[model samples]
Target: MKIDDVVKDTLGRWAEEATVPQGLADRALRRRRRSRVRAFAVMAGATATVVATALTVPALVQPSGGEAGVILAEGKPADDPAISLTGPPEVSADPDATPPTKLVATEKTAMYAYYTWDNEKISDTRQILKQTWYLYNPDSATYEKTPWAAVDVAAGGHVAVLEEAQARRVGLLGPEGQVRWIDLEQPASQLKWSPDGRKLLLVSYAANPNEQGVFDEDGSSREIVPVTRTGFSVVDVAAGQAFFRPLPAGGDAWGRSVDLHWSDDGTLIWDWDTGSESSPPPRRFYDLEGRPHAAPPDPADTGQEAGLSPTGRFSAIHSPDRSAIAAVRDTSSGAITPLKPVAGHWIEQAIAWSGDDHLITWACELKGSAGCEVSEFRNRLLLVSVDGRQAVPLTGFRQNSQKPGSWEPLFARR
Candidate 1:
């Protein structure tokens, strides 16, 4: 069949090879509501190929293992440095509004936990820093929080705050909530602990933009300083000292931010700019030392919305076709797996790396002219394993068009 015909047929109606079990829609919807903060929190700060690199570490963290690791990025690579807040400021809220702090189940046992906290902005210029942290284990499910902070536990059963300021000194709190650790520094942006719970990945902004002014919803000119480059650091959780990886030098990606995901073996993976005006354009992978390793062959074909599989050995890039998903095997010789085209209509949304080596996606409504007539406004979730199988439809939902979203399980059900 012609590609256009396939796309049209798949998009018009909710076409799926997989059956949607009873209550699957309700289950999927419930999961979406429960995981809202976790999913959008980190993803909000992710940037296009030309924006800032911010870290939105998940609150619930699972330790990944094995020799080599997988690398992936999430969503359409748009350069949006603006910050959005869902809840009110952390200050002066009805005590009842706060949910009990606790650990929660993420997709994979070794999956990355993403959560957000809204704190009051003491300074008018600073938006309440909605700090994002990654947590693990019992802590992920039953974790609790004090004012302005969240606690995370690791697999080894060791507990720590996913806050950068907390690293300076930690202490037991008294019955009155007085902190003995007395963290004096401002909180960092995206702060997370390593699998060992012995290290921290804290993302700090290199420059704070001056807020010129606030504007109404209309397109009025508000004098605001645009947030520029954001830098990252790896701190020894115990030592409190951190090593820094500044933005790539003289590259357009300096401000065009990207998301960060660690492989099972602890390799840092990100989507970044590799081509210069004199060179071809492509998004490539770099090591911790800021060195390039895997550069895509065709710069234009190098799309974004990348995610690292749970196993850490493979990565899937979301593009127009399944062939856009790139899988990498980190071995002595190192290997690059190209994307394979999956059959059926799919959306340009975030991709999740499942524990069982399968891929899941949220297929969006394809326009009639785009060649897909499945539905003028219908959306569905697709499940396709990494083995190049036909895409299977799991569930369908009325297309929101705006704010349409879905989730991928990092681990297969145990």
Candidate 2:
């Protein structure tokens, strides 16, 4: 069948779904999900000739492993130059309103690089999450819109995207107009840039990895399970090479956290190894070759997302006594510093360190409550000092909404 016909029929059945909400099925022109569904349909019927033709990248080359790894650019690849963040002053706060296109970032982090999710029902048991990416453009000092289904930005403003939602290949666009591409032997849906912006960790799956299908579609339960992840590939853009390895098979994948990220040191990549159905999956680590490896040790483990603030001075860990309040602890003395709460919000997790003392975090909504709701859905990106004295707003309040206005922010290190 034609790709368009296949996509339409699948979506047609989903629109008639009574179990899910209309927000997913509405399919307005602006919020159309054809790109998301087309991914799955193309994978099932796409031929080798069609894929080769669609690649279009003229400078296609093979990886050192004898597999396809295309590098498209003129002239010899040059060394990565130094990158710095400078522009308008770092703004302290903004009124809680629409999604901010203009964002202020620190030397180490950028708020303009983020993404929002869209859900599409494919079957009684399966659904797909489409990510709309907004990458930071240092040239304009503002966020530039990107409609690519999957993309990731690095600390140095380099971007890795799934050229298309099909996930067969990965595309690289550097800050200096340097273009590169990689053809993973398998289909991959997720792309994460390494800390140094030198490599990409591409997670491959039997089907599109974003497929968070209903845990039990025949029943009324709404729990979601990730699609089967087969393996991953690590592509070194400068070297113009990629290495693929399959994930160890075993364990119950139901409701497992499938997102894989780079180790703090960037030497290893990590994910969970679901062993038993009754117990939680242990955090498993792997080397670049996808071999079983040890986890990255937290020398001064603060139990906070931002492990240690730059100078190893402060961290935002949970309050020793009050679980609702987050404590700014001095790693040296292990003393809990008092955190001042905002008018109707309290900082929860620390995303990245803005400076030696300040952190980019989420300040959740408190809605007239005496104590802050720890996991309250309503929150926004905020910059708070480790001393808890200064509280600044980066982006306005966002929540788990169908509208991109309230979606999770994917911050990239700058």
Candidate 3:
């Protein structure tokens, strides 16, 4: 699995107590990681792999150092659901490619990591999904591969957050692939790095959120769901000290996929609770002590994640109109401003804002109303102006955009 599936699982898993494919277990639960990961892992020097890209940055291609960034698979594949690895399309620009092989980002924001996956059916009622990840190397301007069941790039794109499977510890992975191990009383299913890059937020769980099981009416199948969330920990990055907080889930079974993210100002962490039937619920904040906090500074009336800009002045959202495309709301005046269309058919999804004027968004080549829907949208990452007049492709459009396992990007500040 790629370092990013090491993460895509978090998109959906990270580390797990639940059942995963045999191949995944063999890969994630390795002798080296299971044993050696405890001690301070020596920061072995690494060499960057040369990759072809459309970006104009001066490229530096270095020879591979005997196994700097790569981890070798110890054993053969276990027979259950066979694995087939596919590559993401070509990188940035050239609308012909999808999922993008070469992703480009601005000085303020970068595509730190992305994941692509495939699902294979193991039985009539059961299917196993596997993911491959690509980690972006700022020094080489290329995406490198690594093994992480689930991973999260830190705010600055300099570190990766991951936990050992079945173990009560978390790792802060640095640029050279060196890991700083911090012991935990409980295992975290996922980890979040704050925007200021000073702390690590570990969200604990009882199982791998990616794997679920179903049964027949007569109760013929076994349950695959693990225990709901136990609580969380707020650990200082430099100090390596964790403050444990217990917020146990009662009968309500909420898996780790209801993953927690930090608020814009980095003062709080939150999860969007989908109580029973409501979708796109507002931001539910929690303080460092796990106490329920206040509502978001800005309302996600349009149901956009991270819609509010960093400064909390404007809120970005998809155009309310099917034809108007991307728009931003003036937080002070409550006025919505629609952006001008580029290429006669341009529509922007202003998701990750770089500053007050620009955003890192998705560019869809598909035209018309169908383009607005997820299944029909063939997307690429792009740096765009709030007015929609200028745009730069951060990645090539994605392939198989309709599938749930398709490539998804992890944005980070450079």
Candidate 4:
């Protein structure tokens, strides 16, 4: 019997297998057509490439530097007319200095930094907070204090912030600086905006220490307090309500860990603790409503790094070791297309999905053992395409060098 037939014969034993070939081919053709249209657009606009976008607002762009206030072809900005190019500019060059039409995040030394949804606005942790928000307006290249710090402007201009002196209360601010609602009971330390910019997910520890009589306002505790609580809560911005989702119960499970990611369409994709196995088999996904939504598995091997495409039609997952990237044919179809190797050790680095399924932002260490201890030395950024598997270095991340210009994220114009 032929290899195809032999594999087809035993495929039934698996929990899930590939869908029909014709369907996969059709989707691939559609993807190519979409890509061609985008390529034509990029060629038409030779000045820059867009990385993201929001409602009606021009996505942020990183203008190359040179000629001071001009975008260079190589993506680096030149020294101001007042200062010599020999060293970094010490002082601001006139508030009138044209903020680069884009905000490029190059090597930064600030102790804390906040990159917003549009990347147009940034908050240096050293300066801004709930009471004070330093707003960076790229259009005029100026900044001022706002009511809230680090607002998610990509969505409907709603701002999420932690209330001052209230350890557990998080308040949402409106455009005119009005309080919308507050989650007084729950204490979510970290807040994140959904990919589509519609909702905000607050990840917090489930247990409230104040309720258990562990520590008083004076930092006094009478007796030992044992408690059990750990998980996250999903808040609906439009309806003004929240639902708490508990973490799975089991031994050897990593509790309330980091790295919980949301796709463009707002689907939360994360790994379930299947013990400390070498690979951590059986990854799962949850929709906004908290429903099981795995998009069919590949017939050949187990999948890891399962991510949804920007359009949410197709999802891609990488091998555990980053050898290859396999994507499901579509939302409902289980068929898989294994793309060629795009990066080495993808799990150790950061992967960003651009406007569509065929492209992704590859950020990884350029060299070294890809170790936790040495990650700081390996910091580098790469731009790669899923289809071409071509890797290109973004010069803005050159080690110890100043960035070209402030290039903000401009969404791929759909």
Q: Who wins the TM-score comparison?
A: 2
Clashes of 1: 58
- TM-score, cand. 4: 0.41
Which portions of model 1 show Cα errors greater than 4 Å? 1-187, 192-198, 206-217, 220-224, 228-232, 238-315, 318-347, 365-383, 387-414
Which lDDT value does model 1 have at 181?
28
Regarding lDDT, does 3 or 4 come out ahead?
3
Model 3: lowest-lDDT 10 consecutive positions: 37-46
Off by over 4 Å in 2: 1-97, 138-141, 164-166, 176-178, 214-226, 276-280, 296-302, 365-369, 372-375, 399-405
- Evaluated at residue 320, the lDDT of candidate 4 is 29
lDDT of 1 by residue, 295-388 (tens): 4332222122324554445555422333332333332235544334345453433344345455555454443323223442355445555554
Candidate ranking (lDDT, best to worst): 2, 3, 1, 4
The per-model lDDT (C-alpha) reads 0.35, 0.57, 0.52, 0.34
- Give lDDT tens digits, candidate 2, residues 34-134: 11221121111111221243255334443334444443345423233212356544553344643666655655566544555667778876777665555
Worst 10 residues of 4 by lDDT: 42-51
| lDDT, candidate 3, 40-152, per-residue tens | 11111111331121011111222132212221122221111111112342233333445554545555555566666665555655544444556666455456664554556
Model 2 clash number? 1
Arrange candidates, best TM-score first. Answer: 2, 3, 1, 4
Ten contiguous residues with the weakest lDDT in model 1:
43-52
